[model samples]
Target: MAEDNPKSSVMKAGVDDAKWYWLAEGWAPGGHIREVDFDAQMRGIDPLFEGIKIVDCDTHFTEPADLWTSHAPAGMKDKMPHVRRIDGADQWFVGDKHFGSIGGNVIAKDRNKLLGRLAFQNYDQIDPGSYLVAPRLAQMDAMGVWAQICFQNGGVTQVGSLLGLGDEPLAVAITEIYNDACKERMDASGGRINGMGTLPYWDKDLMNQEMRRIADMGLKGITLPDRPERVDSSSAYVGPDGKVSPFWAEVFEICNDQGIPLNYHLNASLDANSAIWDNLGFDQKLPIHALLHHVGCAATLSNFMVSGILDTYPKLKIGLIESGMGWVPFWLEAMEHQLDEFRTRENRGLKLRPKEYFKQHFWVSYWFEDYAPKHMLEEIGVDRVMFETDYPHPTSLYPGVQDKLVETLGQHDYATRKRVLQDNAAELYNLEI
Candidate 1:
């Protein structure tokens, strides 16, 4: 008998490419859209897969440009990207130049049709109908991905930038709207598609309300940016117990109480490596693109450990999404060294080893590369590593993801491969389907 998760027998019941598939709740679309030429684009990555099962953990889509103006309150709508139809019912562009810049900056376009048109603009045009979910699914079916965990793209826009938006009330409203939309549109798709909720990192009360609302809506996890706008990694504030930053305390309490795992979706912009490009004064894209996700991944794990968050909440299970595993072993080792060398007044009360606490408390998603050291299992523990396809994005191997996993773990026993691909995620997400 075949497995239960994919439910291949009922194609429409789970996820199929026949119709338009919206991956994330908020609008942030870009990367390998189907209406474009895929054959030439996929040639580079497809060679890796002869036979494999694929599961995508991170992928994104642009939001409908007019979301804020349509769904937001009247006072706030004026502040959103202004939209007006031009040539036909489907044609429109951002009207307010200033706010339009925000929308355009977010999606790189004003009109959805133009956006759709641009999805194919880079390559020879292919009919959107010709290839999309069907080929994508065919690839997955070939590879044997039981399921995937999809996250929002546009949702990450302005999470930290909201600091510059000038109104606390409006910022909180934006966060609530985006999150509620995630639950309604993304998670509601049921099994094949899994959605992550966003939190208001700046406001503690709003964070409390949003967590409750997301849990009630059945979202499995929440996504926080690698760099929060206002809070520094080293800053400490007293909590309800008159300790530092109750936000984390409340986060743990809410997640533990409600069974939601907190996911840190790594972005590619916050690393100091990108600063090298900045000092030379060229576009930051070179280093920004290179170091973004990996560095953020390293920083997030490092921050939680060095700042005593892991020791503070031993039971918390944090998921570092879209961050590949190559850097983790080194980062953890560095933390272990720091713990030993800096056993000074600043580190007085900490009780446990940083690496021990991290392995017990956190999980990371690996994609594209899996050349981890043999001692990785001994250091971070294999149970803490999971798999991701990053589907449809330029980096995604889609059809061949499992082939990579099998190849990487060829020396290992069957059980290890199975756990990394399926069992680990099943336990991490608490996926019943």
Candidate 2:
């Protein structure tokens, strides 16, 4: 009778016998593992803003490894970017050159473990929310954010990497594939996410085509390299000639006419490298390098302000993304002082000071910054400043972000706080909110 009782025998087999069953059911000793419902969690929490919606001007989205190859045309499939293991680590390769590892692009969850390390070297080590739109939306809800303007992950989004292929057709095709993928994510996000499209900025014809393509896809803006010369070494936008090229002027005109803003993100230029810090002591390099990253966007802004581009296309909107606001007051003061001293001598054509143009045609985003708003808001004006979380990045405001924002922004009057948290970005991006 005992031998015939198979069910009883199985129950008597003990913990070891039940291990596979528990694992299959996603069960742990304490409880069953399950996906968190962020939307549900958000319902119990009070609103951060009384009545205004919060719009994050700068957030990031990681592109999956298959984003290009999976969507590539048959002729271009062989040339599309794909991942391969090199020295036991997964690396992104376009043709022969290795771009970077998958790990650095999705560092949100593994940030603690990656304090001094380069990257996690595998997809499994990253947070799913970093690469998936649905998960990202949930994460946004959990953080009390309503909508975000998404930029591509640097490791994969490099215009320099795309141009290094030395294949114009391939580069343009890859960019289109990336834009299409971004548009797909935006479409799926139900107005909660907007993607800034990437362009093959080296070619004027291609840039024009891609800009129109992005607009058709309903994207709000286009991202240009922080250093234009880094994208194309011979780019007319820069050089010792010190004159704005007709090509770039035309491009600006297109953006102005199309109502698309040009977004310049920190380190968007691929020129800077850790190799420059080799001369410094190892202990001092990282900290010093991190300190200087904020200057890139400012440098880009100065270039446009002095180039007379702003004067030419007064209607064109430009945003400096992920660079904090603390440096702006000093930087603008210096620019104004220089313009006053040199405008007549150099025959620099400008009607207003650098700071004036900044307040009118330019916008800057801040995250993890408390001092800038306190000190510079009066000078910079509340309308030109926007807020961002840089979500899913290592330094991102997460978990308690709403509390953090409230603490930082609580002192301002409600209308002023509303502009910083929501209205500025809404108007700049032409967001429905």
For residues 121-179, write the lDDT of model 2, one tens digit per residue: 45666567777888778777666788899887635556656666678788788889888
Candidate that scores best on TM-score? 2
TM-scores, one per candidate: 0.68, 0.82
Best by lDDT: 2
| lDDT on C-alpha atoms for all candidate structures | 0.52, 0.68
**Worst lDDT 10-window in candidate 2:** 20-29
What overall lDDT, based on C-alpha atoms, would model 1 receive against the true structure?
0.52
Candidate 2 collision pairs: none
The C-alpha stretches of model 2 lying farther than 4 A from their native spots are 1-46, 86-88, 103-114, 231-234, 238-243, 268-283, 344-346
Q: Cα lDDT of model 2 overall?
A: 0.68
lDDT of 1 by residue, 122-240 (tens): 11122221123333344444445645665653322344345445566776776776666555544334454566777766566677787778887777678765544223332122322
